[model samples]
Target: GAGVSQSPSNKVTEKGKDVELRCDPISGHTALYWYRQSLGQGLEFLIYFQGNSAPDKSGLPSDRFSAERTGGSVSTLTIQRTQQEDSAVYLCASSLARSGETQYFGPGTRLLVL
Candidate 1:
């Protein structure tokens, strides 16, 4: 496919464990983002990286959630000391530019913490 894609379609972990989710955007794209949706809640933005510029991390809820985009293509989302409350479907999106850009989403990666 020519769209965004994610790995570890599903992940199961215990409280206090750590997990890493991955996203691969379309080639040549310069902007990447990470988001998540909890049960019955709306999608929440986590972080975004654009080109060689400093990453835009204002949307991250806490320091525990972090992401990095390498070479303007692949991105990894890491959750440290996972908690049950962190259970959610993680989504990744990518676009060419921030202004007037249309993001393309990848199949979400579901995380379950017990």
Candidate 2:
């Protein structure tokens, strides 16, 4: 893909259900990130993977929120036991190298938990 892309542009799930959000980053990007944007709020960092290093998951809000990047390209974010508070736009971004580099964003996945 020319840029990052995410699956299921919109998702609606009931409380306590689980959902998986996928992200396909640019071919050569070495850093991938996941973020959450609540209504009317700024982007909140969720997790990020850099090269072969351990992913920085310090930003994930809870154990229910987890993500993984495989083969250094595609990533998946899984939210378990979804809650209404978790309803938001889940965004994915990729950068050429480290965390501070400029990132290319994908169309976000809007998750609505009812």
Query: How does model 2 fare in lDDT?
Result: 0.93
TM-score for each predicted model, relative to the true structure: 0.94, 0.94
**List of clashing residue pairs for candidate 1:** none
Off by over 4 Å in 1: none
The backbone clash count of each candidate, in order, is 0, 0
Put down candidate 1 lDDT per residue, 29-107, tens digits, no spaces. Answer: 7988898899766798889898889998998877888888877789999999999889999999988885978998999
Deviation in Å, model 1, residue 19 alpha carbon: 0.4
Quick one: best TM-score, which candidate? 2
Clashing pairs in 2: none
Give the per-residue lDDT digits (tens) of candidate 2, residues 1-114: 588999999999999999999999999999999999996667899998998999999999999999988888899999999999999999999998953689999999999999
Best by lDDT: 2
